[model samples]
Target: MEFLQQNWHWATLAAVTGGWLLIDTVRAKADKTLLSAVEATMLINREDAVVIDVREQAEFAQGHIPNARHIPFSELESRKNELEKLRGLPLILCCASGARSGNAIATLKKAGFEKLFNLRGGIFEWEKAGQPLSRGSKNKDKEKGKKK
Candidate 1:
């Protein structure tokens, strides 16, 4: 009790941090829309969900989920009309990591994308899970090299 009194500031900080972590965990769990790579794949295959890669062109060219439509985060607002056809289907958003897609989710939700999901760990997690990536531009580069 005396030690805690002496280290009250430290104790307070630890308690606050723990509380924040608990809240974050609970919030994440409550959000049933966040999908793991495997879950996203199942949705894609079974429900015909549309995968939208919110990463920039360069990041996307490196590799992305197969058949993912590239609409850089910056252009999502203006180019959202391009995705009107997919509004009724489940829309899975992804980026290099998960941050960009999280932001994209906000934009999409505002646009009435109800059946939306953010890839929990993005393409990095998908690759880590040994899921295949479609290297669109890279394959072109390789083919060009062969021609030369």
Candidate 2:
């Protein structure tokens, strides 16, 4: 009790942080929009969900989940009309580390997109899980050189 009195600020900060974490966890779970790589794969296979890579062209060109459509995050708002044709499909949004795609969710939802989902941890996590990546011509060229 005496030590806590001296460190009241620390205790308060800890408590607030713990509460924030708890709330975040609950919110994430309740939203159910964050999907693991494997789950995202299954969703694609079973439901034909559209995978949209929100990374910049350079990052996406390095490597991206197979069949992911490249739509840089910076242009998401402006290019939203392009997505309207795909509105009915379940859209799986991804980025380098999921943060950008996580944000894309609200943008899409506001556009009346009902089936938006975020790839939990994004392409980095997908690559970490040993999932296959489809690279642009640059990587293809490197692979071709290795073949020769």
Candidate 3:
């Protein structure tokens, strides 16, 4: 007890850090806002949720979740109208990582999109989870060819 009393400042810092962590954990749990790759897949397959990839065109062409619509983060506000038809459906936003998608969520939320979700850890996590990604601009060409 003598050692703790002498290092009271250190003890206080540790306590504060631990308390902050506990609060953050509880807050995160209380808000089921971010969806994991598996949960995203379930939403896509079962609920027909609309997946919007917020990465840039080059990044998107490299690969993306199958059927995900491309809308770069920079253009989200301007291109938002294109998604109006899908407003009622769950809109899942994704980027290279979670940060950009989280920002996209705020943008969509301000536009009154209530069923918005951020892809937790974004495409990185999806690939890490072994989810398949649709690759290349050629795939789009192939899809168009099928329609003709």
lDDT of candidates 1 onward, in order: 0.92, 0.90, 0.91
Clashing pairs in 3: none
User: Once model 1 is optimally superposed onto the true structure by TM-score, how far is the C-alpha of residue 13 displaced, in angstroms?
Assistant: 9.8
Who is ahead in TM-score, 2 or 3? 3
- Top model number, TM-score: 3
Residue-wise C-alpha lDDT for candidate 2, range 72-145, written one tens digit per residue: 99999999999998999999999988899988999999889999899988888999989999888445657887
Off by over 4 Å in 2: 1-25, 137-148
Expressed as tens digits, the lDDT of each residue in 11-126 for candidate 1 is 99999999999998999899988999999999999999999999988899989998888899999999999999989999999998899999999999998889999998899999
Better of 1 and 3 by lDDT: 1
Error of 3 at 91 (Å): 0.5
Minimum summed lDDT over a 10-residue window in model 1 is located at: 133-142
lDDT of 1 at 124: 94
